[model samples]
Target: MDVKTKMRPQILLFGDSITEQSFRSGGWGAALADTYSRKADVIVRGYGGYNTRWALFLLHHIFAMDNRSAPVATTIFFGANDAALPGRNSERQNVPVEEYRDNLKKIVQHLQAISPTMIIALITPPPIDEKGRMEFARSLYGENTMKLPERTNEAAGVYAKQCIELAKDMGINSIDLWSKMQETDGWQKTFLSDGLHLTPEGNAVVHKEVVRVFSEAGLSAEDMPYDFPHHSIIDGKNPEKAFRVQCS
Candidate 1:
């Protein structure tokens, strides 16, 4: 590997569709990339529509035990799809609440085995607006074919609580997106584009929360140096000198 690549640390974002879309315009992952631009590489490994069970099956591949280049931090976000109601079309993604908690614990254990010192962040699933989600489902499957949303806020809340409690039990940082987004009135309209997905504003909220947690962990932007000197500070006649010194 090149000096630059070898020197730069990474932050891994692993989860389902919410994570897949995290690099979209005005998304939280994108914001993190920008925020840590030179300091770290934000690597996203999001599997759309995947739940904890499927994720467990693929975890070994995504985070190889032999890979010594472990990330400085990793965020495990799931449960949106897993919160699907029983007997619904989305039941395929549904995992029992206890299993969901166990899966999260296992994921953390796996990651720790890879990097004992790596910081781990657990993000609980956000709230779901059943009416809006059902409307979206109806639009896709036809009104007569779809009677209700596959996921509900109540069910999601249970999963989110389990996630938070597990994180606490493990002594890892946890982001309670479920409760934070709903702190204001009419969060469904303001934060969510669909009943489950985040709006641009919602993305901002997540970005802010991530920064807050990182800061609390003493990984503030100010504490981390940029990958290389800024253009304004680099010697115009010999930019390579700056790169060599910084990346060495």
Candidate 2:
């Protein structure tokens, strides 16, 4: 393929609703795309309300080993739905804590098989605001809703810690959103939208963490080449020359 037309390496964001919403206005995924604009393609594959168990079956379809466009890096983010409380949509999304950790290991192993060099990052589920989430849940399920919320900050923290531990065991990077977001007072009001989802400010937090992790993994933006010369730097008289990727 012509160098100019060559496919760029990808940074895949794979997860559930949080990942799905990562490209929303002022979202972390959008920020990453802009930051890596000419360097790498930031692709998102998010399945709303999906747990790790459901994700396992679909992983092969998303990252076929035969595909030439292998991702340079992949973020396997889950656990939010997996942390769902028993008897509250448990049949649909909940997974035991031990199983949750094991599923994450399986995911990493699968990615390693696809490409041993592919950088993997695991993101712990962000903390949930039980009060706010319960309110939201009540609104969705009516006043007759159950006593406990579908997800809770405490439960999410447990899963988050496991994710961090899993990352250490697998020798991959991990982002502890569950702990970082709650470090400050009134974090729930500032960072979360409806107890479960992220607010614009929350997205910013994730964006910063993503950059931090990517940098630590030696994938700094400064080190990556722009896909093409900046428009301002292009010669107006011969723009095509600027557009062409020079053969080394």
- RMSD values, in order shown: 1.6, 1.9
Off by over 4 Å in 2: 2-7, 240-248
Clashes in each model (backbone N, CA, C under 3 Å)?
0, 0
Q: Compose the digit string of candidate 1's lDDT tens values, residues 146-207.
A: 67668889999999999999999999999999999999799997998879999999889889
Tell how far residue 120 is off in model 2, in angstroms. Answer: 0.8
Give the winner by lDDT. 1
The model with the greatest TM-score is 1
Candidate 1: lDDT of 132? 80
TM-score of candidate 1 versus the correct structure, residues matched by position: 0.95
Clashing pairs in 1: none
TM-score of each model, in listed order: 0.95, 0.93
